[model samples]
Target: MGEENMTKTTTKALMAAAAFSVAAPALAETELNFWSWRQEDIAGYEAIIAEFEKTHPDIHIVYTPHEAKAYNTILTTALAGGSGPDIIHTRAYGSLENISSAGYLEPLDGQVDLSLLSKDELLGTTLRSDGKVYAVPFASQTVVVYYNKDIFDAQGITPPETFEEFKAVAAHLKDAGITPLANGTADGWTIEVMSGAFMPNFYGSDFFGQVTSGATDFEDPRYVTALGKMAELAEFMPVGFEGVDYATMKALFTSGAAAMFVGGSWEINGFRDAGLNFDMMPGPSAEAGGERMVATWMDGGYAVNAASPNKEAALEFIRFTATTPFAQMLTDQLNNIPAVDGAVSSDPMLQKVASFHSAATPYIMLVAFRFNKPTGSTLLQTGLQELMTGAKDAATVAKDISDGIKNAE
Candidate 1:
């Protein structure tokens, strides 16, 4: 009860409280590493991360963006070496399957709540054979033919509804001294997007599944016909078309040098900023009465690494992606179709793109079909290039693709 004893006890208690306060911050802080191939998406993702950090002050996100061409190889190397990022941006379908089969991905089944997303947003293509989810689908994209409205209006050409009409339009544009289609085969992957836009019209939705299941192969008469059609279309492109790269192709279309660009919905913002009046249409059907189909699929999204040192923090970030704010930011800023349900954008081009979903089919070779190590896309690209150069016939190109698939297996 003495005054000196009471003063000493109070000072000791205050010192202990100060020590605990200093240690509390250290215990609460957590950092998560996120890896993605989209450098263009950095601003949108950073905005989302900043918002996420507001509610989760203890968590810090280290965003690392890689070049698209080198991302897969680099990510595979890192994962195989057992030192990959905590969060990974993964492509859907075969790419997901390839990584999941290697046991590099954490199954999101019970760890993350995706119920906020609709069934369509769950991306059935990313589901494993056992029905477990390995990733959260973030966006959906469709391969479309983006035509310059000014160019079309100048020539009085309406968008074609049938393959015959498409051919006629191309001829008309060519006769007008305008390049009909802007494509860059030099990048190799552009052929996949180009083929995705056209091949489904010839073979239908079931064709890709049949090829994967061995019910039909690439050497079929239909595939040869598709190759022939591609070659015929190529004739409308500029001379030495293979020399054109992606930038060149985009320039040709946006600068009004070319009448149309064959690409995905992701290019809308770039085209809009280029001051070109443009619109999109679903890929035309092969026959006059054939179905009009658009090549649509779930694009890449985020997944957790099974070997991550910060698994819980990674899961928390992934769960946050399903929230309304994140989805809205994706739509408003990136102009992408968010994978979350009820996430709508006021962008007119996006609205027009979504209008074609009723006629959409899974992107044939990209999502529905499982490509082996070398990929059917690569083979088809090389074959089409050879055909363009007159070094290979449609039948021979088809046979080479069939044999490549078989050999890869």
Candidate 2:
């Protein structure tokens, strides 16, 4: 061949090589976005994602953590704009209902193997709604009574079992010049549990169910009794509780300024890691001298965005989170329970927290998911806060909660 012809052939070969490289399967990588509430959650998630990426080299994930306060609002705005992450964590039953109803979350029942997972691993009520599952159970944190063992021993007081004993202890502590209970009433949700969980024990487990189902009136005697008990408890709590928040309240407990505190199991790890000497027991029951059982609520779970472009990948992520090292990490490292079955804690404090849940008899109260709407609990929270401040009487607070539910309907 001539010199010019040879040069043209070399150029053509170089162009074909570049085209082949561009068209290769190695270049076809799938990317998905995930949004979550906790910044700390990202580190664990990233560790999982790193393993996942190694297994599936073609998939790349982008994870973003949002501050808890900004989480739902940001997700709402993104969903409205038709742009958001492929996966997100949401509140348990009621929240799942709202997001699913709004067409923002995909039904995850058939996509994941629910039967293989243990019923105990999940918040049981969350797994089904009318016999159909909507989201994958992720992390669960249950509320429990946190007591300073040193204080209880020093005061010669045992942790309260029944409501009457609880009152006696509070009185004893008060007389001893120690606040029997240290709580942060500034958080509206804290106050709601006092009225919604602690007091409702007098009415039985089905009390809230009846109210939610509209079978009972809001002005019923049961609700009034519960509200009254809440006010009574408030009178015995430490002063300046209204100005406190969870962090401050936790600090007080860790610093040994308070004898007893009520919070979720999530705080156990923090307290343990802080080297605080504390013991946990169930909250007081309504029946005098009855078994030490109390109302409880679910904390966290994973849900897939209905509008996600990478639905399959998101479902896989949910499955992973509900299983193995990720599941164990939630309980082991973060001091939270896994939504999967057979999850146990190696940490002694977490082990106690789990034992309390296992020993719960008759029923584990569903205090949080009282309404289907997202704002239902908030309304309850607001009413409880007003009641605590004496701005609203117990009857009016009860009426307001009932009225708010009616309006939500």
Candidate 3:
């Protein structure tokens, strides 16, 4: 009896060991690290990751959100140091070009099936000059003049149709003890938005394309005139705007302290949450009878690191994002215009912004045009700041920008 029992127990132990060995490999998890700079997007992405993990139990996503201003430098340093996240949140145009040129990004062209996305979505500013795709498009944005509807109604002011009327509206708002505009120069990027929005209206739609083709320079009279108009608007902005940061500017506009906010469509959700009645329109044309032009471009999207070890897993995550569920979540939850084709957004403001697409032009500085070696977006920012502070005039700032580019060459 003792020998029989011992033999049976040994056989059971061997069978259990073999079963455990067979299952261990299948249970092992593959983790993909995702990096992004949208702190506001953490909750949305977390939800998506949770849903993704439900379907793919063997895969995990580790999301790291960095501060917006320092994200590029941090990402570049990490990529250059030969260690970085598996998936990178890259900006369109110049930033993407810089990273792609360094061979840090994996081409999504053949690796990922982007057939579900529209051509407009796939071939945005993320497309390289060689016609290769470096990143999957996520969202698109257009710069528009967001006006406080309550203030406008109370002041009996309708939307302005011309440059003079725009200035008059600002002056009337200022006289009514309201800050006519909210602008933050401390961060420097918003100035680019201002320039991108106005420069096109003054110089015409083909202006940036011409600049990209070497047919025009930054010192063009139209550019200078745009700066002069911006300087005029600055007079109606909050006192000490030079020290205002982005948060302050947003707060000022959302809190009803300012009558108008000149920014991108990305801010629509935040404004809607503030419960303020607002409407957006393309900024007034610099010409008395000319049409307004909205400055638009692809915001950016996720890209795979060329050196990532978990390339297939990263591609799976990207593919997951392209699915209808995740694409709709991006539109509904984040209020972003999703890159996926027929991804309808329930956001009314975004729809309203999109309605102006017929009159839109590319956001030149950020989207189409590139800077020469020494000068780039930062130079343009500084020049605009100088113009605002009276440290330089329109012509001088324009010349400085042109010289910065030319001298760099």
Per-candidate Cα RMSD to the true structure, in Å, reads 11.9, 13.6, 12.7
Q: State how far residue 359 of model 2 sits from its true place (Å).
A: 6.6
TM-score of 3: 0.88
Q: State TM-scores per candidate.
A: 0.87, 0.80, 0.88
| lDDT, candidate 3, 178-292, per-residue tens | 9998886887889788777666788887777777788989888878888888788779878998998889998999999999988988888778778888998888987677878
Computed on alpha carbons, the lDDT of every model, listed in order, comes to: 0.80, 0.66, 0.79
Candidate 1 global lDDT: 0.80
Better model by TM-score: candidate 1 vs candidate 2: 1
Writing each residue's lDDT as its tens digit, candidate 1 over 168-266 gives: 999999999999999867878787788778877887767767876889999888888878888778787766888988889999999999998999998
Candidate 2 clashing pairs, residues 3+ apart or interchain? 121-339, 121-340
Ranking by lDDT: 1, 3, 2
Query: Mind giving the per-residue lDDT tens digits that candidate 2 earns over 1-409?
Result: 6999657545544443233223213434678787878665566677767765665577688888898767878888888788788877676665555565667877766676554344553444343445455666776565677889888888888777788888899888888888777786887766554443366466665665676576885678777777767777776766877887767777778888878888766666577767877888777787865445555455656778888877776776665554444555566556666665434578787677667665342222233334445355676677777777788888897787677666665
Give stretches of model 3 more than 4 Å off. Answer: 1-28, 117-131
Question: What does the lDDT read for residue 264 in candidate 2?
Answer: 68
